[model samples]
Target chain A: MQIAKVRGTVVSTHKTRSLTGTKLLLLQFMDAQGQPLPKYEVAGDLVGAGVNEWVLVSRGSAARIDDGMEHRPLDALVVGIIDTVTVENNRLYSKKDAERG
Target chain B: MQIAKVRGTVVSTHKTRSLTGTKLLLLQFMDAQGQPLPKYEVAGDLVGAGVNEWVLVSRGSAARIDDGMEHRPLDALVVGIIDTVTVENNRLYSKKDAERG
Candidate 1:
């Protein structure tokens, strides 16, 4: 899994039939320093995360582990919303602080 | 899935029991133009890919879909040895050409 930020929603009406109801969100993966990377990915939002929120993304076929997602062609999924991230005893990111800013 | 080049073998004598017989290969993913990206990943070798060979890598839980790999904690697997990659009708890479060089 990787940490990412929900950048925006991606509304696609004409997609694979099995993906009709899945909410796709545009996400930018974060580096170890809590900064966003250059590339972007579209992932199924399994946890109802909103835009600008930090999230945990499960990649590849693991995205299908959740109930009712087994047959979808989803390769990326937003599995959990992140509240904070600590590395080397340092608080790299805090959701509350980001919200306040 | 992504196209990657096998950089070398990773010998780990003491690893998770389920991975005892699995061969680990260090790989570097390639960009669209066939240039290798900066990062490297270690993947279980499902196919017999050699160092310097380009291969197709199946990532995440998909790596576990092969027979007898269901219990392993492997997140990446070399699924296929590449012969060539043609993009826009141009041959970007060919195993034979690479071997000759």
Candidate 2:
């Protein structure tokens, strides 16, 4: 799993049946210090994470374990909305920070 | 999912019970052309992939869908071994090529 920030949304009119009603969000990978990396990925939102929320992006087949998500042809998934992140005892991210930023 | 080359192995005697007997292989991310990227990851192997083999790394909870793996706390998993990859009708990799290189 990796920390990431929701950057935007993806709108696809044509997709596989399994993808129907699945919210797709654009993500910028972030470091432990809550800094964005120069990397991006489109991920399926399973946790109702909104844009700009700090989320945990589960990569690999682990992203599809939710009920009804199997065989969905999804590679990345937003599994958790982080409430707080502390690295080396330094608070790096919290819901309040996301709300204000 | 991404294509990667198996680079090494990870031996962990102290891991979660679900990870017992799970082969952890180090992977170097690869471009579609079969060139290695600078990025690397440690992925669980499920398809009996071996070192130097080009395998598909499934990210997210989708990695744990295999029978008996649903609750495994794994992030990345090897799903397929590449026999041949032809992009734009240009053969970039093949089992035969991997054997020769």
Winning model by DockQ: 2
lDDT by residue (tens digit), candidate 2, A1-101: 89988766544433334456877666778987677786665677888987678899887666668887786656888999999998788888889976887
In terms of lDDT, the best-performing candidate is 1
Return the interface RMSD of model 1.
Answer: 10.7
Tell the DockQ for candidate 2.
0.09
Residue-wise C-alpha lDDT for candidate 1, range B46-91, written one tens digit per residue: 8899878999988777888999877665667899999999999999
Candidate 2 at A49: error in angstroms? 29
Question: In model 2, how large is the Cα lDDT of residue B8?
Answer: 94
- TM-score, each model? 0.54, 0.54
lDDT of 1 by residue, A1-101 (tens): 45678999889888889998999999998765567789788989767888998876667776776667788998887666666655334566777888999
